[model samples]
Target chain A: MAPSDVNQGSQDDDVLQEAANWLKAGKKVALATVVSSWGSSPRPPGSQLAVSEDSTFVGSVSGGCIEGAVVTEALEVMESGESKVLEYGVTDELAWEVGLACGGKVKVFVEAVQE
Target chain B: MKTSMLDQILRDQEAKTPVALATELATGDQALIYYDSATGSLANNPEIVAAARQAIQDDKNGTVKLDAGEIYFQTFNPPLRMLIVGAVHIAQPLSRMASVVGYDVTVVDPRQSFASPERFPGISLNHEWPDDGLRELDIDRRTAVVTLTHDPKLDDPALGVALRSDAFYIGSLGSRGTHAGRTERLKGEGFTEAEISRIKGPVGLNIGAISPAEIAVSILGEVTDCLHAKEKKAAA
Candidate 1:
C-alpha cells in the first residue's frame, strides 16, 4: 500500500479518527489504513482501523473487504508493538484466495502507534 | 513500557471527548479521532497535546512531556469537521456520508419547519440562520460548511456568516446563472471577490446528476474533495 490519495468520510476513516483521539490521550494503538484500492472496494484509501492494547477493535481497514486478513495482521502488530504495511490484492496461484467482491484491491497500511 | 496514554484515551473516549487514537496498524502509525461535537474537546489529552500546539506551531501534532502520561500526539494532525447548512433534502444523504468519514457534522437552518430531528434522523441538526445561527455554533478553522438551500434569504445570509467565519469549504446550491446572481448579491453586500471565490456555488461535483438523491451524492463528493483537498494525491 502506498498512501491515501482520496479522502473519504467513510466509516473506516471515522473509526480511525476516533483511534487517533485515543493515541493523543497516550494510548498504545495500531492503525490499519487502506492505502490502495482496485475496482469496487468498499473501503477506499484513508479507511483505517484502530486496535487497542488488549486487542479491542475500532474502525476497519476493510468494509468486510479483507477484514479476516487485517485482524490477523493486527494480532501480529499488537504482539511486537511494531508498525508496518501489508499489501493485499496480491494474486497467487498457490496462496489461499479470498475474492474481494468489489474486484477492487485494497492495500492496508498497518502501523503500531507509539509516542 | 506503560499504558499511560491508553488509559487517558479510554477515559476520553468514555467521556465523549473527540479523542484521537493512534496505533501502528502497519508500516507507520495510523491515527483516528472520535469527535464529540457536543463538548468541543479532546477527551483526556496527554501532556503532549499542549506542547504540540505550542512548539509544533501546527496543532495537528507535536511532542511534550508531563506527569502520569506519555507523549503520543507525535503523529498526523488534528481533527477536521463538516458543516452542512439548510436541513433540506440533500443534507440527509450527505450527512450520512460525512458521518462515515467521521465528521462531527452540524446542519444549520433557520426554518424549524424543515430542520427537525424527524427529517434528519441521526444528524446534528441546528435550526439557526446561516448569518445568525453560525455565531453560536463552532465554525472554526477546521470546519467546512455547505449551503444546500437555493433560497438566498436562507442561503445567502448563512453564506455571509460562513464567508467571514473560518469554515474551510463554503459551498452552496445553485445553477450556473443562479451562482452568478448569488455572487452579484454577495458582491453587492460588500463581500470581496476573493471571499466570494471561496464558495462552491452550483454545489456538488460535476456528475450531471438529475435526481435529488444523486445530487446529494454528487454534492457530498464535492464536499469530500474539499475536505481532502490537501490530502489528495498529486495528479498521477
Candidate 2:
C-alpha cells in the first residue's frame, strides 16, 4: 500500500512525458540518454535528460557532473535536427573541462524530437 | 525520435507491456521492439531486432555492434510486484522492505481486521479470500507470491493459484514439518511433485533469521536472488 504518488510511473517516464508536453506546446525539445557507462559512473545506461529550447530541463544523465555541457549540446541538436553521440571519460581532456572527473566513463546519445 | 513513436512508448507503458527502443547511433534512426513484433525505421533490420529482443530479455540497457553501426537498446519493463497472502506480522515488514526495493506490494487476507489500513498504513490491502484475491491481481512473470498465514485453509488455496501462474517466486512460511504436511495435502489435491516443489517452504534464505524484520530481509534477499538468477540465465 505505497502512496499514490509512489505508483506514478518512473522518473524516466516523467522525463519523457515532460518532453512530450513541451513538444505539444510548440517548444523544440531534445532528449539525451546514457547509452553506456563504465567504472564508478553514478547513473546507469538508459538514464535520460530532457531539454527544451528555453533551457528548461528534466532528469539527469550524471551526478551533476556533465549536465551543463549536455544542455548546451542539446540546444545544438534541436537546431540541427540531427542526433549525435558524446563520450566522456576521466582520461579525456574534454571530461576534465566538463568536470566528469569521477573516474568513470559514459556515452550519451542526444537527439531532437521530430515533429 | 518521432513524436508518434514517443506516444506509442508511453501508451505501451501504460498498458504494462515490455518494449525496447533501438537507436542506430550512426544515422539517428530508431525503432520500437516488442517481443514478437517491430516497428519504426530500424524494424527492417533483423540483426538490430534480434539484439533488441535480447536486451529486453536480459532487462538491461546496452549497445550492440552491428555491421552497419552500433545500436543502443533501451529496455522499458513494467514494475515488479510482490503479493503477500497473510497480512500477518511478517507481511508488515516484508511489504515495506519490498516496496523500498521497487516492488509494488499488496497484502491480502480474508479477515478485514488483519488487513486493516491502520496496520498497513500506505500499503495496498485486499480483504478477499486468498485465491479470489490472487486471481483478481492476475499474477504475471514479474510477480512474487508469499503466503505467510500458517492456516492450511488459506495458504493451500493461495499456493494452488501461485503454482499455476507465472510468478517468478513462490514461498510459503512454515516449519519443515508443517511444509511436509502441506505438500502431502497438495499431492492429495492432484498437484504433481514437480509443481509442489516450486514452493520455497521455510521461505527465505537461511540466514538464521530470528526477528520479524530479519526474516523480511531474508525473504527479500531470496526474491532478489531469484530475479538476478533469471536475468543471468537469459544473458547466458
Candidate 2 docks at the CAPRI level of: acceptable
lDDT of 2: 0.87
User: Model 1, A1-115: lDDT tens per residue?
Assistant: 3323343333333464566676676666776666456555666555667776656677665657567677777778767876556666644546657546545676566666554
Cα shift from native, residue B67, model 2 (Å): 3.0
DockQ for all candidate structures vs. native: 0.20, 0.28
The runs of at least 3 residues in candidate 2 whose Cα sits more than 4 Å from the true structure, single-residue gaps closed, are A1-11, A24-26, A54-56, A91-95, A99-102, B88-101, B113-128, B135-140, B160-166, B171-222, B229-236
> Tens-digit lDDT track for model 2 on B1-236?
98898888989878979899999998899999999899998999999898899877767787777986988888888878999999899998999988878788999998999999988999999988999999999998889999999899999999999999999899999999999999999999999999999899889999999999999999999988787674346434
Which parts of model 1 are misplaced by more than 4 Å?
A1-59, A62-70, A73-115, B1-7, B13-79, B233-235
What are the TM-scores, per candidate, against the unseen true structure? 0.63, 0.73
Q: State the weakest 10-residue window (summed lDDT) of model 2 chain B.
A: B227-236
| Candidate 1: residue B74 Cα off by (Å) | 7.5
Q: What is the C-alpha lDDT of each candidate?
A: 0.63, 0.87
